[model samples]
Target: MTGWLLAAVALAVGFWSYGWQGGVLALSVIVFWLLLQFSRAMRAMRRASESPVGRLRNAVMFQSRLKRGMTMLQIVGQTRSLGQRRPELGDDVWTWTDDGGVGVTLHFERGQLARWTLDRPADGPAEAPVDAPPAPAAPPPAA
Candidate 1:
């Protein structure tokens, strides 16, 4: 809706500047770009809303599998401390364990650990148990 209005405005301006043919072509390209961007933004917003829960569940499931395999361990907890900056679209924290080792970290914009990285665990003993913290509260909207 907003996209259409903006596109209409652009078309009107383009027509005024370069006549119908140029305006139509320019407007078509601009509209196409705007629609693509809008869809991507919508998907990102949805995914960000759901990610903390999804990460917690995945981490818990992985921990359970590890315990089943004679690896005495617990899910303990998970946390998603907000990074200093927002992550790019489709990025979030993830945790997993395998025969090689257990690991957890953020999956972010350009690469993993865009914010911080926890030290890798060794076989000796688990570090201080840290349960996952509650998700951060959403900020209030501006008036």
Candidate 2:
């Protein structure tokens, strides 16, 4: 790929300018960069694991902060938790829901955010789920 080609070119340049010593220096720099990237990912995952999966505190605020082309690690870092996978739609589809019944669905391609949508609760008061216990009946008015 292009990255490999650029690395090769850098190695060649380093060797051409200062022989083996330059090559070693260039390789060390490249390794350090890779290590830094790996460390960043580990940090993000650690932050994400502290919270419950697929849950958000403020879905609306998260939506507002979203930007196209964000990496999955970046999204995880922002949300502070892993999204719930939706593999039925596609391999990279995921969603997060808030306590208010709002949700956000996101689609990622090549590990970068391709598109996303915010799903809000429908108009009208919230209703309990079908399996929820029925409300108690009110007592008759006193005479």
Candidate 3:
């Protein structure tokens, strides 16, 4: 932002003396800077959290800690897109897994997380029971 301000001021000065072309060049630099800033922000959001529990803490602190099958509008409110729709298994079911293998499968009625399952074992196997499937890809919204 500081750099942008300085560049803006410089552009104005250039417009005053160096003509339209110089002003346009300065404007292009400012535009590029803005784009760079936007890309950085997007990247930050994508890699924001590897644990929803911690994210939940940041979004809204809980009295105790969250458990499996917990449902909330925020859904831990992590920066990454958590909506993984899978209509084949059930309607409006979504899954969100982080890099750390901690995952949550959410069942949505409307736009809210109605039911969820958090899978994060300390020393157990990665795959859960055969009857109960692990977190799968969620289907797209109904047209």
Candidate 4:
């Protein structure tokens, strides 16, 4: 991966510039950076675990905050919970639902968000069933 390549480059540069001591310094720095990243990820996961599965405070707000190419970790951090994986749909499909029964389905490709859709329960007064016939129009009043 890119991270590995960068680390390798850093090691090579360090050794080329100042011998073994520089290489040791570069390795230490790299390890420290990796540890920081790991710690950050663990913190996010811990926070997320405090919430219910697939449940967020406001799905609409979450959807609004979403941008293309966001990683799964970023989305999890925003939602404060890990999404429900929908492997039946695809390998990378995940869904998060709110208390209102609204759901946001996300599709990721190559570990990045590709697209997402929000599913909201229908609101307002109920309408006639599909099988019901249309009601006749009322006659107009005489002029």
Best by TM-score: 4
TM-score (C-alpha, index-matched) for candidate 2: 0.80
Rank order (by lDDT, best first)? 4, 2, 3, 1
**Model 4 lDDT vs. the true structure?**
0.93
All candidates: TM-score? 0.31, 0.80, 0.35, 0.83
lDDT at residue 136 of model 3 (Cα atoms): 80
| Model 2 regions lying over 4 Å from their true place | 1-5, 123-143
Question: Clashes in each model (backbone N, CA, C under 3 Å)?
Answer: 2, 0, 5, 0
TM-score of 1: 0.31
Which window of ten consecutive residues has the lowest lDDT sum in model 2? 1-10
Better of 1 and 4 by lDDT: 4
Encode model 1's per-residue lDDT on 1-143: one tens digit a residue. Answer: 67678877888888988899869887788978978877865655555455433233333334333321121011222222112222443344444333243344434333323332332446646555578676799999999
Compose the digit string of candidate 3's lDDT tens values, residues 1-143.
46867987979987987799889988888888879977865564555445443333221123124344444333433433445556785977766555555656667665554566675648756666779967888999999
Instruction: Give Cα-based local distance difference scores for all models.
Output: 0.47, 0.91, 0.59, 0.93
User: Which residue segments of model 3 deviate by more than 4 Å?
Assistant: 49-143
**Cα-based RMSD of the predictions, in order?**
19.6, 7.9, 18.3, 6.3
* Model 2 alpha-carbon miss at residue 60, Å: 0.8
Ranking by TM-score: 4, 2, 3, 1
> Per-residue lDDT for 20-117 in model 2, tens only?
99999889878887799899999999988899999989999999999998988888988989999999989899999999888999999988899999
